[model samples]
Target: MELHDRRQAPWHDDSFEGEMVAVMTVGVPGGEVLLETSRLLLRPWRVDEAVVQRELWTERDPRVPPHRRIDEDGHPTVAELEDSIRTHKVWSTGLLAVERKASRDVIGYCGLVDSGRGATGEPELAFELLRRVWRQGYATEASLAVVGWARSSGYERLWATVWDWNTASRRVLAKVGFIETDRKEVDAVHGTTLFTTRPL
Candidate 1:
């Protein structure tokens, strides 16, 4: 999964509760639905959680574009994020908040996004986790849940694009059943974007 764009792209790019019963309610419109895994909860972002989003912006790698980062003027302020959360309409295919079930702390986001890079209705699989949660299998776990969600929702396939340099993310995608294809979009500054897909 590309770890960058939350609303406009595959890259660039939330929390939780309880004994963690994994629940998935299908047939929901606007992506306003909930899902859970043994250690993660995938759900919509609350308006008050803009701070977390802002923190994510700050944590982005320097390779990310300035606009996606905090920016010189702090363009994507928490207030701006709050307003975005108030207005953005997450589609049936959307990026959901990933929360750590045990601590109820939102670690990041993992879900499908319409990057306009695939066939109609075939959303891209995207995920980004806090630097603190990098190696505990959270991305793989959350991604598996999203893949299962997409398969159950009738999607025929799912795509994921990752920077060739992002080996960690590539590993996560491989673990979740995505296979790399020859497709590539070269970004001279960041690296080549490698495309991968998994058939449902």
Candidate 2:
């Protein structure tokens, strides 16, 4: 798909707020249905997209803090992305690829993961977008769609953590109706992190 200006695209809508909608296709075995938002597609990661995943890990915007960007060893090699795909397959929920509908370019990933932080089995929402797409509403838009899907799948609640200094991501979580919880944790990688949640 050719990339287009999402802001002016005609397919954008707010219907995700009311129901769980999907594109009528089978997703990864045991995963949730494929999801589509006004400007994006949320689906299982394809093996062919490993190169894109590597790019996201290696080419992040310079403004991203060291802890958030690629590790000292540099970008994840294609072999690593392939291994990650196998791991995502076993997740109770997806770590779906976020693709621009207009261009079909894989941007990043968003979905739920089992958290070990508070309650051991709580599901946590997670997302990361390509740096080039920063400041756009894609993160918020994709998250709302994921939340809708999670609710339909019978999840009662979702959790997330954002580094204190990553204010931009915090705002995206807030926009999607996530409220900060009274929990904070210290991480070796991210320092102090704030926890947030949204009830399904």
Predicted model with the maximum TM-score: 1
Q: Write the per-residue lDDT of candidate 2 for residues 1-200, one digit (tens) a residue.
A: 00111012122234665542344233335533467876888877877788878887787555556764678686467887777776656222367788898987988988776656645445788898888898888898889887866665556778998877788889999998899988887766546789998887
Q: Which ranges of candidate 1 are over 4 A from the true structure?
A: 1-22, 26-31, 91-93
lDDT of 2: 0.71
lDDT value, residue 41 of candidate 1 = 81
Over 4 Å off in model 2, which ranges?
Answer: 1-14, 17-32, 59-75, 90-93, 118-121, 187-189
Error of 1 at 21 (Å): 7.8
TM-scores, all models, native as reference: 0.85, 0.77
Each candidate's clash count: 9, 2
Query: Cα RMSD to native, each candidate?
Result: 7.2, 7.9
- Find the candidate with the highest lDDT and give its number: 1
